[model samples]
Target: MLISMTSEPELQNGVGVQDSFQRLWTPHRMAYIKGENKPSGPEPTDGCPFCAIPAMTDEDGLILRRAEHAYAVLNLYPYNGGHLMAVPYRHVADYTELTAAETLDVAALTKQAMVALRTASGAHGFNIGLNQGSVAGAGIAAHLHQHVVPRWGGDTNFMPVIGHTRVLPQLLADTRKMLADAWPVD
Candidate 1:
């Protein structure tokens, strides 16, 4: 396995890391964050989907990898179409709350997820990140996990600049199949 390295500095203490994450991601959300607590996205209601994925044997919005401690699902509101998130089963809020084993397991699952996404989506590269704290842009700032998003050379362009719309080329289900076929054992 290859180790991931980030030259990005340790998140600055009071810099609204969440906003930075948001801006770096879908620029359309920039308006919502100008003076708001949350951006306009799918709000987790009742039972959080990440927590419920393991028990249910369904795949409506579920994209890929359903397991005991780890799972991958397509972001309903994604930066890119095949954007995937590897979340743990428990309902922990921040990264510091995760045990070393859970942290390691999450990382392993994330790497495999990136490989799976690449095989299925034909992405040239990726932007894998974690929104650690609510202050750090954790939309579900409640649950901690890493997002593995695929990117192509000219994926982001004029619309996001002039129209404020973010476009993705493929259906999430197709992206799911590509991923499932690539990493079915998990």
Candidate 2:
């Protein structure tokens, strides 16, 4: 005789127990956790996503704005909904390697990113900085990029704290379009 597991209920709970929690399935995040698009090494040609982003169209690369020496793009793995990053066109591993012109452009673009994020998302504030190396939490240490993360009051919730997951309401492409359209005209 074969015992059928299909007849069993998924779970059994006490009379007072209730399953009220919901799961937010974000399968796309597996790519990031698995380091799919990450650079192989410090070389620009070694599969560096930042180095390759400029070559693609704005929409395709999720680029919000482009300057002579740098550009602003939506973070693929954003900490918040409207996270952005300012990166130099030339791939460099360290902030100290930036030329004067590159440095200026990156700084200007970072400022513009805050404005665009504010206009597009009504962001209450921002956290802007760089993680220098892999040891310092830089996901792509091969390319220098400054993060411009938007923050709102009470934005942090139980999801990130208890579930170890972030629930971003808008899609990256949509966020990119919003920021690109709201970018300051210079």
Candidate 3:
């Protein structure tokens, strides 16, 4: 049987299969998929993103706040709308390596991030934790950072499960602006 190019074909079950989905061609995501932004080596000077981000301007790095020994920056690849990470400047791989000062600063920054995210996005809740090593799902295992993921009701949906795509409603820069503006002064 000859099939017409203009119309969708019928399946063996006699149901018409229409080509409905419009492709959201995210070419920029190719770099992430190919691991382009990942660090070249274990050393901080060897292209560690967490280590390098603090050196850049706040807008350039999507940084929300900076403390003495630690800082908070928006996640480049966010699982949710307002995902952020609190990281130490020293580029220590393990949490145990943090000095008392670094530990306190990181914790303070994380609390500040939560308040910023809440004020910026009005998020209902959050997921805060750390993935220690590559085996534990740390994408950048050479640096230690605490993830602060904002959550909303029904944010989990079929798109991620069925299409393997996350539907982010806002741009990263815009999200950064909102969080930055909402960040506490102290």
Give the number of the best model, judged by TM-score. Answer: 2
Q: Pick the candidate with the highest lDDT.
A: 2
Worst window of 10 by summed lDDT in candidate 3? 1-10
C-alpha RMSD between model 3 and the true structure? 6.9
Across residues 110-137, which tens digit of lDDT does each residue of candidate 3 receive?
8898888888788899999999999999
Scored against the true structure, residue 150 in model 1 reaches a CA lDDT of 83
lDDT of 3: 0.86
Model 2 misplacement above 4 A: 1-21
Evaluation by TM-score, superior candidate among 1 and 2: 2
TM-score of each predicted structure versus truth: 0.69, 0.88, 0.87
Clash totals in order: 2, 0, 0
Candidate 1 lDDT, 38-152, residue by residue in tens: 3233334444656655665536756477555666777766788778888887777677887777786688778788777677667799999998766777776766668988889
Ranking by TM-score: 2, 3, 1
Cα lDDT of model 2 by residue, 6-125, tens digit: 323335563333355555657788889999999888898889999999999999999999999999999999999988999999989799999999999999998998888888889999
Candidate lDDT (C-alpha), each: 0.67, 0.88, 0.86
lDDT of 2 at 138: 97
**TM-score, structure 2 vs. true:** 0.88
